[model samples]
Target: MPSTTGSATAPLRVDARPELTGDRRIAVLLSHGFTGSPASMRPWGEHLAELGYGVRAPLLPGHGTTWQDLNRHTWAQWTATIREVFEELSATHDAVVVGGLSMGGAQVLRLAADVGDRVAGVMVVNPAVSTLRRDVRLLPVLKHVVPSFPAIGNDIKKAGMDESGYQRTPLKAVHSMMRAWPQLIADLPQVTAPLVYFRSATDNVVDDSSEPIILGRVSSTDVTRVPLPESYHVATLDNDAPTIFARSAEFVARVTG
Candidate 1:
């Protein structure tokens, strides 16, 4: 869970124009989770690129640095970063599918709602917007008293593999995200793009609280839920990652075709 500094944590963009390539030229925007950097998603991005898809994974604001700096960023900044990447990709790419992990999932849902059919499709891994944790009830006051809590990073079942995220959780940033859930949920029906949700059967960081809400409210009649039994919350970096990578390529092909 400890932070690590390297090019691995930097933002990644793999450009492959449709004019040069063929059907696989569809672009995909991959967003990382909160307290997590691009490192967590780099492998998946690379995999998609290997399949001939253009890929981008942006480091959210205040991430790839320190947890203390993460507290300085709000949900707006984080969401804006993803939105910007979508805009950038949309400008050149004929079609762009948006996807994310954890908080990144929620952020892409926001984009799906905002841009509607402009998004070719949607994919999410362990996307979380709600929690069953009881301690969050005290965030209103506790955020002011305590700066952060223990790390929620490195919740992977994969041994020796780190998510390369913060070693601590920033309470203020946590509160900001939690506060925006109501609006995000309210806007769920606005999301009409085809959605493929990749959820881990057992996740330590994000519970099943968000699944029902997203699946039930989304207006997209075309929805598929794939369960990953062999991984934890950071399933993108876990054993079932290949399942995700392969299925995700098929998903992009299905939606973009």
Candidate 2:
């Protein structure tokens, strides 16, 4: 992974609120990954907002503050936050697209499954649904003994880019995410919204097995997978970011048109 100059010990950046344009008919609710703040998704949201689409990238409950904050939050609270934003957007927008990165991706999938056809489209980048690593399986027990681990934030392949996520990984939160995975997978068949999935060719954090699990299980007939050749897990901030922003905007237009 490419390295940046910012200090991981520095304070997390503030969350980015929805930048609403005059055109409220089209709205997008984007969520960042588990430990990540809205900074990772703000650029993407701003691009869409510039196109006259209303975009909201809410900070997850425990993110963008401290690692201890994340440990205090659960998977249910994370899902609840996104769901509320999605519902609010749905009320005003004629079309709404729910998207996220990594864990955020799984959260949006759950939203699509819960709301079904109401969602105009779904977008995900380097979605983490299932992990092939046996180590994650130990989360249930390990979380009790271990309080934290090395951070998985800032997995970008681009230099000088700061994701502003937590400096450490909270084991309790990781355990909560792992516990929710099975239910998310089980609900995949109910996700009938059109989907555009972006998978990185080389991701150091999320394993390759995750892509197949999501693609194979989702019930959406209208699905497209684009390969991010030069990016890693945080493709939103990597060299291929422009590709994701442009394609996702096009996808929204196509689905909502």
Candidate 3:
């Protein structure tokens, strides 16, 4: 059963706990996408936990709450939350693999760049570093007037599946993310950890532009790009979720073993 214990001020979905496995020596920090709660990464975290790996799918600072709350926070708060968790895990774990979906992916990439060889490996699904949309250029001015736009969640091909993310896209928060993009791209060369990238074929949110930018800039020699044919943007809950789980397990073993 999905636990509904969060307050109205911060409504968390069922299965959105900061989970951990019995084995704490090897940890995996899994991050959910922007505007998304830990619910989006819960299934993937649980699967890894079942395999005796430590998993932590933390809810970002402003997320799992109202969209208005997200507008009040910036990308720095979100990254700070993940950095604290990663540092905590890194202190005790012999090896750590950081993985995320969408914006979560970008977060992990930034971590990998900052931490370098300390991160055993990296995995991401539909990671976004840049946008192809022209409207994004207007964000600097539009954000002042527009509180939010349409929601970007539930981009899954699997029918009836919900990611349990925010219902609307907070323009102010989106602008903060945009501000962080250039820095993330600039630091990409610092990331040398083994990377396993999963790209969905029909993603409506993140376009084809992001993947090439990441692959071209990263210094990692061990890089694998897998295609998710059946899934959409949020592939963690989509059809190829099993593939993601299985391949991720293998990727971790190969790099950390």
**What's the TM-score of every candidate structure?**
0.95, 0.91, 0.91
Top lDDT model:
1
Per-residue alpha-carbon lDDT of model 2 for 150-182, expressed as tens digits?
Answer: 999899989999888888999999889988999
Model 1 CA deviation exceeding 4 Å by range: 1-6, 17-25
TM-score of 3: 0.91
Instruction: Give the clashing residue pairs of candidate 3, or none.
Output: none
Give the winner by lDDT: 1 or 3. Answer: 1
Q: How accurate is candidate 1 locally (lDDT)?
A: 0.90
Question: How many residue pairs clash per model?
Answer: 0, 0, 0
Worst 10-residue lDDT window for candidate 1 reads 1-10
Cα lDDT, model 2, residue 39? 79
Rank the models by TM-score, top first. 1, 3, 2
Q: How do the residues 113-193 of candidate 1 rate in per-residue lDDT, one tens digit apiece?
A: 999999999999999889999999999999999999999988899898877899999999999999999999999999999
Q: Give the poorly placed runs of model 2, Cα more than 4 Å off.
A: 1-24
Give the root-mean-square deviation of each candidate in angstroms.
3.5, 5.2, 3.8
How much is the lDDT of residue 44 in candidate 2?
Answer: 83
Model 3 lDDT tens row, 20-93: 33333677888888888777787787677666677778888788778999999998998998899889788877
Better of 2 and 3 by TM-score: 3
